[model samples]
Target: MRLLPRLLIILFVIFAPLPAFAVNPDEMLSDPALEARARTLSAELRCMVCQNQSIDDSNADLAKDLRLLVRERITDGDSDDEVLNYIVSRYGEFVLLKPRFSVRTLLLWGAPVLLILAGGIALIVFARKRAGKPTGSKLTEDEKARLAELLEK
Candidate 1:
């Protein structure tokens, strides 16, 4: 019983920091509403340096810069959409963690499914071809006669 409690404590200590925010205290906004908006925007923006992590979760220098930029925009009285549009205009849509569904992004999203479907179709066709055919050449009449003569001998 004592061992279980100790193990739980150890696990908690090890995993607790994983979900902690990477935002520095110095960069935080004074207004709670603006700060909340900044935090939300940070979570939606991608860390360009880290590629896969959100700016709010990444410890990279670029991520820190982006977090500050978001706060600055919020403090300047920009609406959430304006902040997002400004960032998108500067960095292109690739800066957004969730890209808008448009023609370009649709191709990015659809390519994998299309490839998998194509591969599945190819596999089915190959399997059918293999199953339907017995790939052997028929012997000529002369070869059959020679085989019969040899067997009789």
Candidate 2:
């Protein structure tokens, strides 16, 4: 009887734990195609509660809601752009890893390269100015001779 109980306990532990990728079956799409779409869309969405995590990777309540939103939009026959735009409108562009390039964000897009070029030019100008310094003494031969004679004494 004691051995049977131990075996049962081992079986319960082995069967009870779920895999990391396991999702609630009700949340899964019956159609594999639609499920793929859900997975792809969810990966793009940021989890608001976990700023750096995608909705698909996060177990947060907000991530769950966002995942449900993606599936609902896909079921409604919305295009990917429409689904993404819906989230962007609610959360602002900060949710996107790669923000849209625009005139308002021109510096954000261009500043690093521009700053590097400017710094390179400034460094060259500084180096040239330093390099151009007179490489020899300006003193007359008489000064040199006097210094040499003093040293000899």
Candidate 3:
């Protein structure tokens, strides 16, 4: 009984998903509402130094700077859209964790679907070609005659 409990605890410790925040205490805003908004915005911004991580979860100096900038913008009474626009202007659209759906990003959004469709079409064509081919080998007349004669012998 004790072994099972210990195993469960070890598995939980190894596999549990925990939120890993990298924001320092000093960077947080005093106002709760402002802090919440800043946090939401931070989660949407990419860490330039750590391209795969959001600023809220990154420990890079650039991520820290971006987090501060977001808080500063929120404190100045900038709405969420305004803050996002301001950051985009400064850092380019690449700063956004999810790119906005627009003409410029259409290719990025459509490429996966296009690739899957192409794969499906190619698979269907390959299956048809395989199905159309004869399954058994065709024997020559001489070979068939030799087989009949051998069977008689």
Q: Let me know the TM-score candidate 3 reaches against the reference structure.
A: 0.81
Better of 2 and 3 by TM-score: 3
In model 1, which residue pairs have backbone atoms overlapping below 3 Å? none
For residue 86, what is the lDDT in candidate 3?
99
Candidate 3 local lDDT, residue 5: 94
Better of 1 and 2 by lDDT: 1
Q: Candidate 2, residue 97: CA error in Å?
A: 2.1
Ranking by lDDT: 3, 1, 2
Model 2 Cα lDDT, one tens digit per residue, 9-81: 9998998884364245677778899889888878777778888878887888888887888888889999888
What is the Cα-based lDDT of residue 39 in candidate 3? 92
Sort the predicted structures by TM-score, highest score first: 3, 1, 2
What lDDT score belongs to each candidate, Candidate 1 first?
Answer: 0.93, 0.82, 0.95
Q: TM-scores for all candidates?
A: 0.74, 0.66, 0.81
- Which pairs of residues clash in candidate 2, taking residues 3 or more apart in a chain or in different chains? none
In candidate 1, which residue ranges exceed 4 Å CA deviation? Answer: 1-8, 11-14, 135-153
Model 2 alpha-carbon drift over 4 Å, by segment: 1-25, 134-153
Quantify how close model 2 is to the true structure by its C-alpha RMSD in Å.
8.4
